[model samples]
Structures are given as structure tokens and as C-alpha cells.
Target: MAGRWKNDLNWSDTTPKAAWLNRRQIMAGIGAAAFGGIAGPALAGLGAVKSDFSTVEEPNPLDHITSYCNYYEFGTGKEDPARNAHMLNTDGWQVEIDGLVDKPGTWTMDDILAGTTLEERIYRFRCVEAWSMVIPWVGFELSDLLARVGVQSGAKYVAFETALRPDEMPGVRSPVIDWPYVEGLRLDEAMNPLTILATGLYDEPIPNQNGAPIRLVVPWKYGFKSIKSIVRISLTDKEPPTSWNKTNGREYGFYSNVNPTVDHPRWSQASERVIGGGILAKRKPTLLFNGYGEQVADLYDGMDLAKFY
Candidate 1:
């Protein structure tokens, strides 16, 4: 299962693993010294096999990835998550699994990661705003998690919810687009091998601002489809409501797949500006499914993407 999918990117496309390991070791030592022999999770290194799903493009810098984000729980600004997410306490994070699963209950982070094998997937992350980045996400398949929970026969959709602590999250105080951000996926889409619950970035535990502990990563869809800081997962017979879609269905669709032919009501989705490419970076033409169409296009067979989108 190491290289199940076709490898579009060579090993040379990413930073050498040896260099990253050495850097992690140094960071761990510094953390141990600073916290009196207690290294933080951020200093801990995750051992993962490089995924075949990784893209060939060089990934965005860690700073750019972390600093520029869309965690609306923190704020609407791109830099707000980096500045305010620290206030969030994920020490005892637990995700509530309910609806149509056999094992419907609150599962701790430890329980979630217990039998999971993490993989390093460097994927093209396309935002609905027409910006994109190559990100290295470390996680296990969502299908594995679904198997552990035992999907019921009637389950048709998978719904997700982000944590909403108004005390810690300043943005939640304002009614931007509803408090607890929610998103959903069809059962088959949720079970796809490419769908994962990312727990790390660049081999280190994911920073708080970037959905620490765990987050959903659906590479073929728009970035918002991959909900962060997930707190609830529900298996339902009906299509679950999504925050963005509920806010403005005309602009954001439930499928939210990257389709170059479909322009966003306010902007063009035909091309995207690469984040961290600095000012004046040439926009590149957007690809269907953000270039993962070969793997996911069939999921929408016989249906009109424009209508569903």
C-alpha cells in the first residue's frame, strides 16, 4: 500500500527527509530545555511514509502556510488564526461520533490515533478565493476511521463540525456565518482512500492555527471542504448542511470541487494565484479537481457538475 496511487511527484520535489529529521531533533532538544525536559507536541516528530498522492510541486513555506490561513473561528483576516488560535486549548480534545455508526460516542484524540497509520501527502490545496498552495499533510485515511466506527447500512452522508469556543475564539463572538462551522460529504466521498484526517504538517504536529490534533483533508475539493478543528462527525441519511453553503449557496456549492470552467460568482476560478510566490507571481490555469481529476472525476459521473456545483 506504500505507493498504491500513481506517483505524480518525485522525491526530489520535497525537502530531503534526512534534513527534516535532523531539524526536528534539534527543535525537540530546544523544547526539552525550554519546558524543563517536557517537549511540546509541536516539537514531536511524526514518522510517516511518503504518499503516492503527493504532488510534484514544491510545497509552500511553513511560515506562509501557518501565517496565511482561513480558520474563521479565530477571525476573518488571513493572519488572525496565527495571532489568536493560541488561546484555544486542545489538551483534552474529543470528537463526538454520532448518527448512524455502530460506535457512536465521544472518542478522545488518543482513541482516534490509536490504530491509525499516518502518511505524508503533499497535495495541491486550492482555496475558493482563487489562491492555492502545495501542502504536506500527515494523516491516515478517513476510510480507516470510518471502518473503526462501523458505518451503518443507512448512512448516506458524513457531516463535520468545528469547535466553537467563543471565549477562546474572538471571531465566534461576531455572527459571521454561524458559530460552529459545519461541512459534509457523501458517504462514498468520505470513504475514498484519498480522504484523510490530517494530524501533522511538515513532519511535525500540526500547529494550533492550522487545525492542530486533527482535521479533514479532501484534496480534490476546495480548501473549505476540508473542515478544521473537527469536533463532531455524524453519519446521516440526508445531505448535511454546510456553513458556507448555508451562508451563500450561489457562491459556494456543496460539492465544492475545483472546476476551472465554473467561475466563482465574484471571481474567476479558471486560474489561481500561488500563495508564497511573492508579489507579481504569474497566475497558473486551474485544473479540474485541482489536478486530481483522474482519480475523482468518476465520482460525479452522469451528473452535471455545474448544477451540483
Candidate 2:
């Protein structure tokens, strides 16, 4: 009769309700616009609706939707991507390659999909936005993908880029943030097993706004550091610039570990909202590196998490 694990999103009738209604309408319209031209009446008839709530999950969809995104470019609105993502064209997406790599080339969506079988991994996605989810994502190691491209010895860092279309993503046009978001990780970090370039979610193709085609998922880092709708991957010797750090240097660190003790400049990191909580779930304490320390804590051994955090 209620959410499996009640999230704590209490939409005060005035603020969240109005926000939700407006976003849904805009997102639906954008979806229609993107497909209506191609699929016409058929596409409109086949439009997507909100998913029936997941009963088998511990944290469930409420957590899944809110804690896993850098959708702010869609607007500071948490629901912006879902609303404005209809503007992204994931079907014909292409990932470009350049920089210090020996095998610099381009990859199409088909090329990437055919490269490996999707592996389902259940990971806790901690959003810097102060919400969280335990997602059963479908993807494989970024290391494997990079190996295929033959990373060179000079590759000290790897940079990623997302596609930008101001026409469809009205948020990009507003100057609320920069366009074509960028992110980077050290070469070793890039090779970590915990780093995933996700293609699907809940066993289905990722929704367009969820960085469809493919996106990075680094479990230990904050959500923004792991970018979406990637269109490029580069091997470089110099430290690459990242979106959040450049925009708000003091607040968004280059290495944004999931730490409950260290607070962000704007708020406390000790707790987070259980998104999609349908108005009853409690907010839970956040965890370090989103609880993958068993596998990744070693990556930062001897180094101070607080310093980078």
C-alpha cells in the first residue's frame, strides 16, 4: 500500500507539488517533440509513463531517481533532466576520442554496445544533491573499455564529455550552468572496477535524460564528478578540468568522496533524503564512498579522504 522504504521527500503542497506538475508537463512535451516528428501518432501513443513503484527493492525507485544524477544543467530543479532530457538524441550518439592516446578514434553507439555484454551491478549512488539510491545498473568496467582503445603510457588522466543541445535542453540556454559538461579522473581511477559507463538501468535501456547512450558511474565520488551523456573520452598527461570544481572550486572538490562527516560548504553531509519517498520515509545517514570501501578504499590509502573530500 506504500513505498517499500519510505523516502523523506515531503512535497510541501506549495513548493514541490507545483514544481513536480510543471516539470512533468515540460518533460512530456519535450519527449513528444523529439519523437513526434519521427514516430508521429505512433510515438505519442507509445509515450512513457511513470514506472509502477518497485516492490522488491530495499530503498526502491525513490532513492534510485534522486540520488543518481548531475541533472542540474537541466535546471537547479532536481526533476529537470526528466523534464528537459527529451532534447537529447541518444539514438545516433557518437563518442569521440583524441589527446595523448595511441588509438585515437571515434565510436558509435553500436560499436560500444557490441563491445561487451552488460553486467548488472547493484551499487549505492550517493548524490551531492543530498539524496541517494541503491541502483541495479547495467554496465561494465571502464577499464575494459579503455583497454580496447589501447591507452598509452603517457595517459595520466582521462577526461569525459557530455552532449549539449541548447534547443531541447532549455536549461542549457539559461546560463544557469555551462554547456557540454565535462569531468575527469586519474588514469588509475579511470581503470577502477567501480567505475562504470552505464548503458541501462533496471534492465532497460537508460531513459534519455538519465544519460542514455552511456554515462560514467564512479561509486565513491559524488554524483556530479561522474558525468552523463558522454560524447568524448580523452587520455591526457595534464590534470583535466572538471565542471563543478571550476564552477565552485571551494565546494566541489576534484575528488568528491561520499563522506558523512565532512560537510559541503552549503550543507551537512551527515544525512540525505530518500527520494521518491511518497511522503513517509526517513532520511538516512550518508556513507563514505557510498559503501564501496571494501573494493575501493585502498585506492586512497595513506591519502587523506578529508583533504580531497
Candidate 3:
């Protein structure tokens, strides 16, 4: 896949970390010159690849990131998730992996974590609501997890389901959106390196409202595509149904990539407001593929984005 796409982005220009993280750093030494002629901020834990991770934007402040969220399970208000998500019990969480896979079973969160390594991925998060943020997520590539289950030849899409405990998640009772919140990705999108199965953020455990235990993080797509509090992942031959798309397919498509030119039915998507940029933060032009076109544009070659979207 590396050679499949043209390398247009300056991947070498990446942030640096401690000398102990990898051999490159060890060889460079603490006092050694930084690579790519770009000095990057130091990050702890398994550092991200300079080429794949964003080196430009700073992650949104933890408070802003946590306090402002759209977890409908808690409520519709932005602050609802942060305030009501605590009722969700994350301990002993088990995810059911089934449908068109070699290995299908119920696996605990501990099992999932033990099977993969965590990395710090700094990604640009664009919301369909025309808001954006930079988040540093800690997790392994989603491809790694799918590989563990062994994607079958017949599988064409990956479907996800959020926990649906109405008692714990009060918002499920409401009809604002479909209950047992669901989302999906084409097989190719699921296998993309940028797609992650995030477990934590800011080097700490994920908060309850932010999809604690585990969640899908597809930086290139709208934030809604990144489902939260995931409890199931299914591989299927048919295109899986998604929550927003079900409510009104005209507005939300199955492939909700970040395209500034493709305006949402209700509002313009050409520009997005930076989430944590204070009260007066001006709107910034939305980037194709959320500024990751060089890495993922090939996936949609020749397809009409406006139609798929």
C-alpha cells in the first residue's frame, strides 16, 4: 500500500520524541540534530510515525476535548456526554466479533489490548457539523485488530455497534437518533493505516463520555464515522447501515469523507469552526479528506464523491 499511492505529503517532517523510544532517536542522541529539518515537540509513549502522523497542529486541550462532545447516548447537548457518560460501566467490557471472519468470538477489552501495541497518533478530527479538532489518540491501527480476527474473502465492509444499555445510557430512550448507535466502513477504509481502534487519549485512559474501553477513530472521515463506546465489530459482504444515513440518507451518506466542496444539505461544509479556538475562533476552510488526501485519495479513485457522500 505504501507504494500504491503517490507520496505527496512531507512525511519525514515529524515531531521527535525521547531518545529511548526507537533506534533512530538513540542513534541521533539527545543532543543530535533533528530529522527532516523540522523540530517537533517531544511526545511520550510509542511515538507515531513522522510520515503518517500530523506534525503541524497541536492537540485540543484535554478539558475542551472532554467537555465538548456529541455522544447522543448521554444526551443531545454537547456537554451531555461528559456529564452523563459516567453512568456507563466500562469494566469487564467484552466485544463480540462475528460475521464473515475466521475467528468469531466474544473478547474482553483486556484481550484486545494485550493483542496490540499502543501509539500516539496526532490526527485532525473534522466533524460533519462543521467543527474540527486535533486529537492525540493512543491505540493500534484498526487493520491490526481486523487482521487478528482474520478478514474472510467474502467480507466487504466492517460494521460497528455502540453499547445499548438504556438504563445506563439514558439517551437511548429518546428518538433523536437510532438506538444502539451503529456505524460502518468499507473494507478498504477499515484497512486504511489512518483508521484506528482508539483506547485512550492524552496518554491516559479514555473518559466514559469519550468512548471509554474502545472506539473507532477514522481521521479522514467526518467525526460521526468515528463511533464511540464500541461493543461489536462485524465483517459482512453487504454495505452496513449507519445511524445518520438511516435517519436521512440525503444528508448523510455511507461514505462521509470530509469534502469542503460537498456541502451538507442543511449547512455549508466548505469551512469548519475550530472546536477549542475560543469564542471568536474564525472558521477555517475544510480540507479534502480532512487534509489527508495524499494518503487516502487513491481509495476513492474515479468514484463520484458527491454521489457516494
Candidate 4:
């Protein structure tokens, strides 16, 4: 798998480790003062092998990557997650695995991470809102985890659900789309080698705002399809209902691939604004599958993306 794709990005493309550690230090200090000397656990550095799936482009700055986010569980604003995500307690996180599987039960984080090797994949992330960024994500393939639990023959699709604690997630208090946001993928898509359950960003434990502990990272799909703070994963025989698609099926499709030709109902998807690019930086033309067409286009062979999307 290492040589299946070209290796274009390297350590230089990532934010310096020193800078990331310095930022964490400042954040820890602030947390201590804000929570009566009780700071969050110190994040352990993750060691992962570089992957060929990474793009050649330089990644977005740590500031932009951490500050600008879309975890609606915290709030709808881009900065709200960073400001309010501390309340989310990932201390004893558990993901309930059920539906068509040989072994179905609530599994701890340790269970999810066992018997898997991590890799650093610097992938291009495209949001349905017509914005994009290059991020260095550390995780193993989603297939590994699925294999560990044993996917049953009857399972045709995989569904995911985010944690929904109103006490911790303030945004859930309001009627925003639906509580316990859900998303899904066909069995083949879920098993794709490119799909991963990210545990860290820039080699550090993923920040709360960016789906700490674990989150799905499917580079070819819109950011929303890559659900965050996942609490449940079900292998089902039927296609599962996705939160955004349920809210407005016309705009947010289940297959939400980054197709430049398919314009959003509210805006154009032909071009995207780079997150860390200067204000004057020109919006670049969007690419099909966020420029991962070579790797994922075959999955949609013989199907009309515009119709399916």
C-alpha cells in the first residue's frame, strides 16, 4: 500500500513540532487557570509512518487549523468549537459498535486502537461550504478497525453517530439539524484503504474542537461526511440516513464528493477559498473528489454522480 500512490508531501509541509508544543503549553496554562488548576491531560505525541496518500501542498497553519472549525456540537460559528469544546469530556470515551457484526458491543478507546499501526496522511480537506485546507492527520485505515470487529455478510453500509450530551455540547440544546448527527457510507466506501479514523493532527492528540479521541477522515468526501466525536458505528443492510441530507437532501447529498461541476444550492462549488491563504489569495478551481479522482473515481464507475449526489 505504501507505493500504491505517490508520496508528494513530507515533514517540511507540516507545522514544526516545536510550534505545536508551544501552542499546547499556552493552551494548557489557560485551561489550568480557567478550571481551578485542573488542566486537561497532557497530549502524548503520536509516532506514525509517513504515507504516500499525502498531497504535495503545504498544509494550513496550526492557528487556522485549530481556530477555524465546524464542530456544530459546540456552536455554529467557526470559532465557537475552540471556545467551547473544553466542556467535552473524552476521558472515558467509548464507541458502541452494533448491527450486522460478529462481535457487537460498546468498545473503549483502547479497543479501537489495539492491533493497528498509525500513519501520517497529509490530505486535502474540502468542506461543502466552498472552503478547503491541507491537514496532516495521524491514524490507521478504517478497514483495520472494521476487520477487527468482523463485518458480517449481510452488512451493506456503515453508519456513524456523534456524541450528543447536551450538558457538554451546548449547540445540541438548539434545534440545529438533528441531535446526535449521523452519516453513512456504502460498505465498499467504508472499507476503502484511504478512509481512516483519525486520532491526531500534526502528530498531537487531536484537539477537542477537531474531533479529539477519534473521528472519521475520508479525504474524497465533503468535510461533513467525515463525522466527528463519533459514539456509534453500525453495520447495516440498508443505506443509513445522514443528518445534513435529512435536513436538506437537495443541498447535502449522502455521497457528498467534492465535484466542481455540481454547484451547491446556495453557492458555487466550482472554486474554493483556502483557509490559511491570505485574504487576497484567489479562490482555486475545485477538483473532482477534492483531487483524489485517481484513487476514488473507480468507486463511482457507471453511476451518474450528479444524480447520486
Query: What are the runs in model 2 whose C-alpha is more than 4 Å off?
Result: 1-59, 62-70, 278-280
Judging by TM-score, tell me the better candidate of 1 and 3. Answer: 1
Per-residue lDDT, model 1, residue 134, is: 94
Model 4, span 126-221: residue lDDT tens: 999999999988898888888878999999999999999999999998888888899999999999888999998887788999998899999999
- Deviation in angstroms for 154 in model 1? 1.0
Candidate 3 residues lying further than 4 Å off, grouped into runs, are 1-51
Q: Give the least accurate 10-residue stretch of model 1, judged by summed lDDT.
A: 1-10
Tens digit of per-residue lDDT, candidate 2, span 171-259: 77676556678999999888877787888665557777677879898977887877888989999999888888888888888888888
lDDT per residue (tens digit) for residues 143-221 in model 1: 8889989999999999999998999999898888976999999999998888899999998888889998789999999
Residue pairs in steric clash, candidate 1? none
Tell me the tens digit of each residue's lDDT in model 3 across 115-212: 36576677899989999889888777888888888999999999999999998998888998878899999999999888988887766677898898
Clash pairs detected, candidate 2: 6-281, 7-277
Each candidate: RMSD to true structure? Answer: 3.3, 9.5, 8.2, 4.0
What lDDT would each prediction earn against the true structure? 0.88, 0.71, 0.84, 0.88
Instruction: Tell me each candidate's TM-score.
Output: 0.90, 0.78, 0.84, 0.90
Q: By how many angstroms RMSD does model 1 differ from the true structure?
A: 3.3
Superposition error at 156 for model 1 (Å): 0.7
Give the Å shift of residue 269 in candidate 1.
0.3
Higher-lDDT candidate of 2 and 3: 3
Worst 10 residues of 2 by lDDT: 46-55
